[model samples]
Every structure is written in structure tokens, then in C-alpha cells.
Target chain A: MEPFEGKTISWGEHNGVIELSLHRGPCNEIGSETLEELESFAEVLRTSAGNMHTLIIHSVMPAGFCAGADLRELYRRAYQQPRTSGNSIAEVRNFLVRIHAVFNAIDDAPLVTVAAVHGVAFGGGFELALTADLIVADRTARFAFPELRLGLIPGFGGIPRLKRDLGNGIARDMLFTGRSINATKAQTADLVSQVVAEGEALRVAHALASQVGKFDLNAVRAAKKFIKPVPHAELLREIDIFCELFESPAVAAGLRRFVESNSPLPYLP
Target chain B: MRTLAQTTDEILTLAAQQFKVARETLSPNDDFFKTLGIDSLQALSLLTRLENHFHVELPDYELQDVSDFGTLAGRIQARL
Candidate 1:
């Protein structure tokens, strides 16, 4: 498979390991461009699964791995058209469906996957990391689900994936509080497999990928398939619930606050 | 148990070392955002470092309105 270089992301396979890098500036905020590139990457993964043993997803931006979905774009598109009609919600639901398809593809990919995270991985970014079988985080990495502050739950299969990987109580704590947990706490909560020094997540992840790549491909794929089943039904319900909540007046106000705020800590609730 | 002043002093030292600011320059009352010359993401990084240094889980929400080194130390002290 040919290497891909896109505006928001890029991918290339090396030594049977595909390294997909998220590289949008000011942190990779997953907007339409990112989703489109991610969808393409998912397709590539599907086609190249037979040749790949491991997939490593990490960000090249300095601010973090990803700050989550682009709320500014979401707000712009939502209000671009008339709000009197049902078009906004419909459009949002459609986006959710498409994003879910891409996330689900990664979640159930045949090869082992790792998210080498650093800095802020909040909301949709957290969901994206959840797609991986393992998360290797640097000490600077912070994981959060701040969507509740936006009057929305994590629409990108975060709730279901978090529940699948972690305890229900831990999942609820993150969802309900909308707080950011550091790499140490994330490891304690079993969310991160390894916590390396600052700026070392990608290296640690590569080492992990190398280790996994040496194993029998058939056994690795079988173990992944057996242990990691995609929560299709809950993911669908999350989209529905997100769309339902998107129509509320609070989301508009929340998105408006986020988009317009000049505060340095806008990500904070 | 460390007193609040001790905790506050440690926070000042950590913040100074992490941001490479002069240790004496960061006082208890200085707004860390201004004193450290950092933004929110950097602020979160500081929070994580503080949490690790102190071995406590200080939720970001708890520090939403807290911008000074002294108050941050108090929050960490409470957790301790």
C-alpha cells in the first residue's frame, strides 16, 4: 500500500508496522478534514491488514496528541443553516455515523494498535485513543471527557469504549465530572498501559509495537479479536443520544461559549 | 504531614523548575498563568506535574478559578 500524506494526518507502513501520525497544528482538533483523512486511513488499514502486524497512532503536534473534535467547526456548520429546521441535528447525526464507522474500523482492526499519547487527549481525542488495543502515554498526557460541559456526551464512541476498557465507575467519574486525569492516574485506572517520560510516548509505543510484531501473527490477531469486541450497539445508541442532545438550547450556548471565549483555559469547564 | 506553607513552597519550587523561571520570582500570591507565562495547555501540564510531585489527584475543575501559586498549593495540601 502506498503511503498517505494528508492535511490533518499521514500514514506509512514500515517493517510491517503502520505508523499513522496526526499532525494538524495547535493540536489535532478532529474536524471535517481530520475525519475525512481518518476515514481514508481506516480504509487503508482494512486493505493492508494482511501485510501489517501492528498499527501505531500518535500525534506530531506539540500541544498534545489531540484536543478532541473541532467545536468551532461544529458550531459553524450547525448555525450556518437555519436552526428552525431539523437540518442541523440531521447533519450532526450524519457526521456522527460517519465518524463512528471510522472509529469502529480501528477498534476491531485485525492488527494490534497502540495510541502513543502526550499532552491533552480530551473528548473525541480520548475516544480516538480508546480505539487502540493499548495506550502508551507520556507523563504529560492528560485524558478527559469534557463533553458534558458542552451539554453533550462523547459522541465518538467514547462512553462505550471507556466502559469496555475500564471499570464502569471510572468511566462514569470521567463522564460526570468532565475532569482531566494525568498519565499516572490513567495508568492507575488501567487506561494507560505504560507511562514513559515526557516526550517518550512515541518511542515507547514503537518498542511495544516491535515486541508485538515478533509474535505469531495468527495468534496476535486471534487474541485481539477474542479480547476486543467492538460495542456496535452502544455506539449506535450514543450517536442517537448525542443527536437528541445536540438539538437542545444548552449545546448551542455551550458551543457558543467555547468558540467565542478568549480565555486561555477554554478547555476547562 | 507537611504544613500548608511547606506545600506551598514546594509548589513554587516545582513550578519554577518546570517552567525554568527563577524560584524566588514565583511567590505565593503571583498568578501562575502570568508568573509562568503559560497558557491553558501548559497550565494543565503544570497540574499534572504538581499531581505527580505531590502524589494527589487534583481535578482540573478544582482549579478553574485558581490562578495563583498559593491557592494551588492549598488545593494540593487539602488533598494531602
Candidate 2:
């Protein structure tokens, strides 16, 4: 698909399955170039006929899936270096917004899209996995949203989706503490739909793809239409207020008292 | 049709499996978010586990109100 043009990644059909991969050496860093490739690929696949009955987003890297943005880009921006053609934080956020839209499109595509994850999926990479209809992960898959530790939230839809998936309280811990959930825990948490042996993520995903790819494309798309989008405007405000409340003596003392006792959330703690 | 008892059994079984504990330890009558030591993280974790396990999504508010084994079971049964 031309949506991901001039990028090392690829999208093509083989045996009726459309393969989507980040061919940029598996490291698949979400930089300026990668986001452009994703934007192009998503649009083309969204409309093409039978070109994407099964979309597989596999890593080309040996270590893991995507690792989010390049810190070197951040370092460059702080120094005002002309590296990525006006690569400001706003530009990066804009690109990620497009990336989020692209992933959303894939989730709603007529085909079944699966993520073959093995290794670390951090930040946006972790969020990208959330967008997939199915995540076939290996035992080595480590999922984390470490942005909160860096004073950032999931730039993509991770915050909203994870909250939707896991529930608000648990996701807040993930967002606040930035702790990771290992593969076993991921399977328990339903982060990954299936967990196979290490390095066999792609094979299992392809197998699942084969089973699902033959279904009615229209039906698959229809099911997605019925699914609800994340409703986080209120929750996000609550999160902000929660943060603000953390500073209040009322909330702080309330938290301490609640922690001492055993009161539920509607009360405190 | 699955009875409320059956759905409660399934949901509690799934939640127990998720938290890696004995289902007997979590009382159906106990408050989900506080009693049985169900914190918010574990609460969300259990809800996600239930969603993927059952292949049906509960409304966000319904999911939040699943504060006890009985309530969680009721919520799952209602969706069914």
C-alpha cells in the first residue's frame, strides 16, 4: 500500500492474507519517517478491495516490538538541531495522532488484524498492540506504559484503551507507577489474546489469521461498528482532579485515613 | 439461559484465576473494591480479564460497579 510509502516497512497480499510489517530492522522506532509510512499504509488498506483480509503487524527486530519515539529526536529538539524537518514535540504528537487514527482504521478494517509481539512493547509501541483485534504474544513479551514515570501519559490511545480494557483503577496504577506486566501476567490480564512459546508469535498469529481471514469481511467490520469507543473525557478529568487532589490536605489526609481503614472508593482510597 | 448462579460462578472463577488465588478466599458478599483486598488495579485487571474471556463487553459504569463477587456476577449475568 502507498499509505506507507518510501518506508522500510511493507504491506502486501500472499495466499489471500495481507501482511503488514515494520521492516525497519524490527527496532521499529516511531520516528518521523515511520509515522509517515503508517499514515500512508493505513489509508490505502482501509479502502482497498480484499487487499487486507488479514493484517499482521510483526516486528523486524530481534529484541522486540516498537520502543516508541527516538530519545535522540528529543535530545535534538532540545538542542534545536535540524534533524527531522521541523521535528518539534507538536509535530511528533501530530504524527502519533495520525498513527492512532491509522491503528483505529486497522481495527475497523474488513479483515482481522493481529499483532505478533515478542519482547518489549513500551509506550506507543505498547499502545499499538492494544489497537489490534488480536495480540499473539510470546512468553518474552513485556508490556509497559512507562511514560507516566517520565511525566507523560500514553500519547497514543493507550491510556484510554487500557482503561477501557483493564478498568480505570488498575490502568491508573500502570499509568502512575509505570510498572510492567510480564507475559504470564499479560495472559492473565487479557492483554494478549494468546500466548505462545517464545519466538513463535508470528506462526501462531498466522494460524489464527488463517482461521479468521476466511470469515465474512463485512461481518467482521460490522462487529467493530457495534463496539463502543473509549469514553475517557470524564475519566481523564477525574484523573486530573485526582492529581490535583493529591496535593490537597483534605484528600491527602483522607487517603492516609482510608489506607489505614478499609473504606471503598466512593468513600475514599 | 445461564442462571445468575452459573454466571456468578464463571465470573468469580475467572476473577480468581486472574488474581491467582483461591476462589474460596473472595466472598461473594464482600465489597469488590475494598473487601477481599480488591484494589483498583486488580479491579480493572479483573474486568479486562472478564471481557476477553467472555467475548462480551460490559458498559464502563457497569464494570466499575462490580465491587463484590455477587455484584460482579450479577453484572455479567445481566449482559448475558
Candidate 3:
């Protein structure tokens, strides 16, 4: 794919493996453009799903894998006086639904997927990584869900994913404290499959993908299919609760303060 | 309603059960995470249990720095 100025991903295929790198200058923030590209990419995968054996998600930026959602976009949507696109609030709510669908597409893809992470993967970024079948990170990688500090929850299907992967306690701790977890801690929590040396995440991930490619494609796909799907009902419920909170006074005041302060918001501790 | 000491004893009992240890093995001043070999997630689970038991929602922020049984009891005492 051709790399664009504001684009967040560039993907290529080699030896039945597709490697996609996310890049957005300093921090790869999940913005509208990134989501649009991912939507289109998911469609492409749907049409050519059989051709790929493994999909490796990585980051080209040095600062981090992704710093979660674009705060600017969120602030605008949350605090803007009038509907910017002449759409109703219900229409605005579709954005969350759209994100869930696209990420779900990736999660449900026929090919095995891996996330090669480094630096920081916060909020939605961590959610995206969790969608992968496996995550291999370097020592430099860090993960967190700081949305609670903003009085917003992880609206991009993160709650269900985290709850499924790490159980309710760990998920709630991360959400409530808004603290970052290092690669070692993430591995201990079983969120990361492997922890490599600094700057070796991509290499290790590619090696793992190559090994996975050696397996019988049918067996690999079948194994994935055998795993149960995350409860769709629960995911929808999370989105609903988050949307309700998004419109509450707490979230509104939090977003306004976040924008005004131009710094990380304070939690109780 | 439970007194402060009663609440503390109840919390310690819960903590001991969660860690699968003897009640006497834990002390009021012991750091729950350190003594119990539990992480923050386990601690959070204990917090949830405490909430259900005491019928109070512990403020996540105010308790972020709380580590030991004594401090935990003091926080609960304040709430009471």
C-alpha cells in the first residue's frame, strides 16, 4: 500500500505473510483516517483471506506502537458546541459501532494474527493489540488504559477484550488506576506471548509468523475456529454503558479539563 | 454495623481466605501485596469483596496508595 502523509498504516506481503506497520509521526493515534484505512484493509482481507497465512501488526514509529485514540478528535466530538457534520448524536454514536465491527473483522479473520509491539500501547491502541491472536513485545513496550483519567472508558471494544484476556480484577485495575504496565508485567499478566530484547519485537514476531506459516493452514485455521467467540451480547452492553457515560457530566467535565490542561488528568491517587 | 476493629478483622479474614493462608499468618500492619504475594489485580479483587461485604464503594483514587492491612482498615474506618 502507498504510504500517505497522514496515513497510519502501510502493509506488505511476503511468503504468505502480511506485515502491517502503524505510523503517525510522534505517536500513532487511532484517528478517523486510521480507522478508514483499517476498514478498507479488512475488506481487502475478506476478499483475499485464503491467500494470507499470518498477519503481523507492528509500529514504525519509535515513540510507541500507538498512544490510543486521537485526543483532538475525541475532544472535538465530545465538547464541540454543534454537530460538525450536521449529524445527530445518534449518528455520532455510529463511530463506536464502526470501530467494533472493523476490529472484530480482524479478530475473526481466517489467518493467525500477531502484534509486534514496542514503546507504548495505550487505550484503544492496547485494545487493537489485544485483538490479535498473539502479541510479541520488546522490553521497551508499555501498555495502559488511561481513559478513566479522562472520565471516559475504553469505548473501542476494549473492555470485553480485556475482561476476556485478563479477568475482571486486572482489567478493572488498569482501567481504574490509569497506570502503565511494562512489557515484563504484561507478559506476566499473559497479555504478551513473548518478550524480546529492545528493538527485536518485529524480528521475533516475523520469526514466529514464519514458524506458524509452516503449520498446515487448515489445522491453524481450524484451531482458531474452535476457540469460542467473545460474547457479542457482552460487547454490545459495554458499548452501551460507555456511550451513556460519554454523555454524562463526569465525562464531559473530564474531556473539557483534559483539553484545557493539555496534560494528563489526575486520578484520585 | 461493624466497629472499626470488627471491619479490620473481617477484611483480614477475607484477605487470608483469598491468599489461602491462616488468619494468624497475616497482621494488621502487613502489606497485603507483599505478604500475600498478590498483585494489584488480586488486591482489587479483595477491594471488590470488601465493598460487597461493607456495602460501600471504596474510592479508587484514595485507595490507590493503600498497601497494608492497617491502612486499608483506616480507609474503611474513615468511610464508616
Q: Which model scores highest in lDDT?
A: 1
Report the C-alpha lDDT of model 2 over A1-269, residue by residue, as the tens digit: 43333565777777657777776643576766777777778777766735456778888676577766554443344334565654344544455556667766765666677899877677778878887777888766667776543334566677667866676655776677666665666777767789887689989888987887677777876775667453446334433543343333453343234335444332111
For model 1, what is the alpha-carbon lDDT of residue B44? 88
Task: Evaluate model 2 with DockQ and give the value.
Answer: 0.04
Q: Give the TM-score of candidate 3.
A: 0.73
Candidate achieving the largest DockQ: 1
For each candidate, what's the DockQ? 0.76, 0.04, 0.07
A171-227, model 1: which lDDT tens digit per residue? 889999998999998998999999999999999888988898889999998999999
Q: List model 3 lDDT by residue over A87-109, tens digit each.
A: 43464478788888888888888
Ten residues in sequence with the least summed lDDT for candidate 2 chain A: A260-269
Candidate 1 residue-wise lDDT at A239: 91
Poorest 10 consecutive residues of model 2 chain B by lDDT?
B57-66
Cα RMSD to native, each candidate?
Answer: 1.5, 12.6, 10.8
Give lDDT tens digits, candidate 3, residues B20-59.
9999998898978778887443454466557656655465
Q: How much lDDT does candidate 1 score?
A: 0.91
Highest-TM-score candidate:
1
Error of 3 at A58 (Å): 0.8
